[model samples]
Target: MQVKDGLTFQEVNAACGVKIVAPDLEKSIAGTTLHLANTKEQIENAETAIREEWRAIYEKMPIMCSVCKEISPRVEFIANCQKGNPCQVQ
Candidate 1:
């Protein structure tokens, strides 16, 4: 699930742990860019509130392992830590 340059859409989605439901990938890309631009403008208009909301969301997200700081889901990370396994992304 490693995301790097020159990867396919599926690869990117796998890396990000998301799914695209759009019928057309190209149109989806364009629409997403446009939506992000619009959202950026809206956020600029309400920067304080948006920033606070984002901070709350970020704080609720799963954290990496305290031992090695590896990227993984919380359950897997705990299992690795309890088993004394190396911190690796599954």
Candidate 2:
């Protein structure tokens, strides 16, 4: 198989880039089995929970002006701009 950069085995397999190989034997042997402990639904639920937690934290945080280093809600900053008073960065 060809070596590719920055790709997981699952990604390559999904892209049909991987080839499964086995040895030729005279007698039959038992095949390997994989048991997935976490189902797809469990993984999705975990990701959703993480995103909700982060969103809750982000909502409480104040926004900082890139020009003046002022920390406040974004709406207040926009109001200042609307009043013809822009941030002055020294």
Candidate that scores best on TM-score: 2
lDDT of 2 by residue, 1-90 (tens): 655454335434252554444455333223322222278887687667656765665554577877788887656667777988657667
Residue clash pairs of candidate 1: none
Q: Per-model C-alpha lDDT, please?
A: 0.52, 0.57
Question: Candidate 1 on 1-90: residue-level lDDT in tens?
Answer: 854544235224232545444446663323212222247767676666555665565555576666666676556556667998847545
Candidate 1 is scored at a TM of 0.25
Kindly report which residue stretches of model 1 are placed more than 4 angstroms away from their true locations once superposed.
1-45, 66-90
Tell me the spans in candidate 2 whose CA falls farther than 4 Å from its real position: 1-37, 66-69, 73-90
TM-score of 2: 0.33
